[model samples]
Target: MPNLDDKNAIAFEFARICSLAAVKIMEIYKTDFESRGKDDKSPVTDADELAEEIILAELEKCLPGVPVLAEESFAAGFRPKTDGAFILVDPVDGTKEFINKNGEFTVNIALIENREPTAGCVFAPARERIFVGGDDAWAGTLKAGETVSPDALDPITTRARPSGGMTAVMSRSHADEKTLAFADAQGVVEKVSAGSSLKFCLVAEGSADVYPRFGPTKEWDTGAGHAVLNAAGGCVRMPDGAPFLYAKEEVEYLNGGFVAWGRID
Candidate 1:
């Protein structure tokens, strides 16, 4: 039996699952599928549903009986028992980008334990890129419909803060006044735009310095990317420098304002 407590094994297995789901996502993406709004008015497509289904089935085999708070499943009112550690999944992280065919959308999965993400994977199908976090973080290319292997992946880490000003990455669509102000207050010299959890991957690979968001988000939306950033020598924290915790049942897994930095030091 696979060791569920082994983060490296978990990360790699989760990544393989994400890669498999991305193949189905890309297959539907190439079709003329329609997108519809959920009860919360968020966009969802067949790709999202099918991808989540694939992930869930694989999770049953890999880590049976572990509660999964998957976006599609939760939206469909299938709330599993999640009193203890659970898995968070966002089958399609950037629905707008997917709808627009911008190639920024991703499939995200993370193991959430004790209010922290222990391991995770983020796979962008259109971009053929995958990032995984275990005992460490790694980035690699995996073509849609291709099998995944960690041997080719390169270890990734965040860079030290630049001596000058920081390069801030913001949401391509979900920008808010608070996030803009935060960037300005930090004296950001350069700014980059990204959709979905790719902002976290950018920072994890040292391509950006920070990503700040003070707007609405769900635990599923950030868990995978947060794990990657954390394992890559970066971290996510409240603007006040407090730790970012998850499993907010009172808020239905809603996440508050937080910033992701390449390195706090």
Candidate 2:
């Protein structure tokens, strides 16, 4: 395995891997492909499988023997043992958005150490935007089929909650009554609807102040975004104000209600 102490290298490598997956995802996005339902009734597509295959293969070459808990792999009944450190990957987050052709889906990859996310990358191929966070947080443009260097990334930080009022970004596909209620409770001046982990990126980049998810989610779905938000001076916490943890063996990787805050008061 690569040096786990070198977080910078891990972050950069994850960005590169996610970018490669994005290239292929964009290709599939342009084609007329149909999505099939998984056992849980969630949508899956060729892009999801292909991107995961590419990422898993690259990870094997980059960090051989390190365990990975990837979305597609778990659904396929492959669960690797995880201890102090491991990786969580969501090859395609927001498949509904992808199927809708709304340009909101993302490729997510994250490193978790001691149950906390240490580094991660979220790439929205259709938006041509890639966000990476680890020792540092950055957002950059990514042209389809092109490789980008870490030095080329622009640093990003979360802004303080606006003095006027906070802005909230809600999940477009998964927003439920409870989530809406939470947004309303925040007294946000504006509410934006987005898909995938982009809601976390929006807060990380200061475009929004908070993202409260009250619905069902998995660790893989939130780990990468949590890392980015943390690196950008933000945090994800349970509704009761506890820190969000990963790899909960008892829960089967599922996450409970949590609130992502750009500015923690």
Candidate 3:
């Protein structure tokens, strides 16, 4: 088992890499950056490549020989060999938001140990905010100069308790019928729309209560936000209510259906 100190180091390094990537992403965001759509029709930008390269370089330096599975490098044919640990990276989680200049995008990084996310970080440069999660609680949304403020150390919330009516959040880009059906099954009173992992953050902060994702997504897309929710007294569970897991080879790094709730019961 990894010690608490080692876990903290992982969280810290993950945040550092995310912060560095945030700077690069913002640089490209401020200018006219070219955008293209991948085969899956998701938007990709220069910011993604620049940030991923920087993150990969830094992670290589800090965690030498550790395997990395990143969205940008996913095609490189590197696979986790079972037995040890690897890092998952999604340099820009909300590329569409970034491309549209909406500033909802983020840099996500997570360390997976024994196929579980032991530590993770999410940085939103446009908001000058960062969230980190690990064994010793977590932190969220530090202003530009403030460093390392610990998130409230409270018990994680398991499920959404109906308060008159529950809140539901869905992807602005990928909200599909199945996600809507799940939300309807919950009898939600209101629904909000957002892009990327910000949906997870919204649920974590209690701004929204639940987020149901039915469309396809990669492990890196949800890993850091899942860790943040876990730290912020919340959780991301499968439709059947099991906690989310990462780095499983069975699914080509793609995630199954999951629900993120402010409180899990």
Clashing pairs in 2: none
TM-score of each: 0.98, 0.97, 0.87
Q: Which has the higher TM-score value, candidate number 2 or candidate number 3?
A: 2
Q: By the TM-score metric, which is better: model 1 or model 2? A: 1
* Candidate number achieving the greatest lDDT relative to the actual structure: 1
Query: Model 2 Cα displacement at 177 (Å)?
Result: 1.9
lDDT of 1 by residue, 1-265 (tens): 3576889789988888998898899999999999999999999999999999999999999899899999998988887766688999999999999999999999999999989998999999999999999889999999866777678899999999999999999999988888888999999999999999999999999999999999889999999999999989999998899999988888899998999999987
What lDDT is obtained when candidate 3 is compared to the true structure? 0.77
| Residue-wise C-alpha lDDT for candidate 2, range 115-177, written one tens digit per residue | 999999999999999899988899999875567677888999999888899999999988889
Best by TM-score: 1
Model 3 pairs whose backbones collide:
138-151, 156-233, 157-233, 157-264, 158-263, 158-264, 158-265, 159-263, 159-264, 159-265
Q: Global CA lDDT of candidate 2, please?
A: 0.91
**RMSD from true fold, candidate 1:** 0.9
Using lDDT as the measure, name the better of candidate 1 and candidate 2.
1
Reference-based lDDT, residue 36, model 3: 90
